[model samples]
Target: MEYAQLGRTGLKVSRLCLGTMNFGPQTTEEDSHAIMDRAHELGLNFFDTADVYGWQKGEGITENIIGRWFAKGGGRRERTVIATKLYGDMGDWPNDGRLSALNIRRAADASLRRLQTDHIDVYQAHHIDRNTPFEEFWEAMEVLRQQGKILYVGSSNFAGWHIAKAQETARRRNFLGLVSEQSPYNLLVRAPELEVIPACEDYGIGLIPWSPLFGGLLGGVLRKLDRVRSAASDLVTELERNREKIERYEAFCDELGEQPSHVALAWLLHRPAVTAPIIGPRTVEQLDGTIRALEVKLDDKALARLDEIFPGHRPAPEDYAW
Candidate 1:
């Protein structure tokens, strides 16, 4: 796997990051460990997880799983660049979950305890907390950096304007600005290209795309109408409900002569602004399929073909907000 620098942080990460949201929910601990082992074997050093994942009851279950992996003492803990997020509703209290100074400190302590680590490689805000002032959030993040709790800061699910405002706030306060952005970008979902990609390019922030396969729509498993219908019924009903989008994705996959996942990921890898595509899979087979995406290089003609298939379709009016 090829490695790239994660924004201005000077940390080298693989082109694909292993995402662990499925752990403890759809995946067993043993399978999660096995996937991590395989990722390491494949030279993937970057792992991304959020505290909100792994359980429907509460937060930090994913981090807890990672803690168990570290406790196993198989040399895996020392070899990976672990990234996690905060600022989601963890059921603490109403308005207790925004990016306030208190929440940032509390979240970092909880994350450290759960991950069994002294420092996080990359710390991120799970979403844009409009309720909190940008200065307060940036200042709190700066304190975390100074305290050695987090090595670098990033933002997820943020728009271009949000990123710009945060950078300006950090600059005025002499705090650390965001170094990377994690957004939804893939062959099927290129909406970020309209704003987020240009902002990252202009400001030197790295981009990590989540749902690079459009929640398995680009994984070739949904090619047949029946299979698509069946898979749609399982989970994440929103993706399944969008019939037009699913059809477009399948047509693009067919034109690429590659699996839907490979086509989806290769498109992201071809972009200069993208640092990595976060890959989340429930099973080893699915993970292997995502890994193969690194090998499917797309040329100019191939890209044109893909563009022709999917075109420049944006999310409908109702699906705009994060």
Candidate 2:
């Protein structure tokens, strides 16, 4: 696995962050533990989860799975850079969600317990909290930092302006602002390349993109066209919309003798601003398969061809302006 600095911070993290969203829902605890073990064996050391994950069954189910894994008494907790999010509705109470300073404090303690960890490597706000002032949020985050409950703070699903605002607020207060931003970025969803990418670049924030495969649309869907037809309505619709391009993309990957998934991941790694692409593999085999991407180098010609097939993004104002 390749390692990169987490934003401007000196801490190093794996280029691929292991996402545990599927832990308690699509995957069982044993499989989750095995996958995590394989991830560690393969040198991946960053893992991300959220407080509201596995909400269908109960809040923090996924975190509980991770907590159990940590309790197994291996070097699991020590070797990993753990990141978890807050800001989702955890219960019926009005204070159960968002970035209110009270909620932040409560959520931090809860996550720490569920994660079986003393300090979170990166504690993130899952989304922008329109109601909470940056002052309030920072104050809470500062308390966590001073108390050694969290090493760094991050944001997710935030807009360009929101990141700017948060960064400036942190700067003004002499606080170590956002160190990373997790956005949904992939070959199919190049939207982040428009503004969020630039904002993160300017703010020295690492871009850790989730859904890097665009819900398996870029995971060589052509090979499983029959199954693709049965996927969710919106995904099938997107497949139909991009059928021709996807076929060509698959052929290109075939010609290069690479899995389309790896090719897609490799493409993201080539981007200047992306620090890591979160990979949520449900099985050990799937997790092991992704390791090959580290060696699948995309040359200029391949990159240009990918650009022609999927197109590239123009930075911010140029994308919106004439």
Q: How many angstroms is residue 130 displaced in model 2 relative to the true structure, after the best TM-score fit?
A: 0.8
RMSD of each: 3.9, 1.1
Clashing pairs in 2: none
Q: Which residue segments of model 2 deviate by more than 4 Å?
A: none
Q: Which candidate leads the pack in lDDT?
A: 2
Query: Candidate 1: which stretches are off by over 4 Å?
Result: 221-224, 233-256, 313-322
**Candidate 2: tens digits of C-alpha lDDT, residues 42-78:** 9999999999998752369999999999999779999
Specify the poorest-scoring 10-residue window by lDDT in model 1.
313-322
Q: What TM-score do all the candidates reach, one by one?
A: 0.89, 0.98
Q: Residue 253 of candidate 1: its Cα lDDT?
A: 63
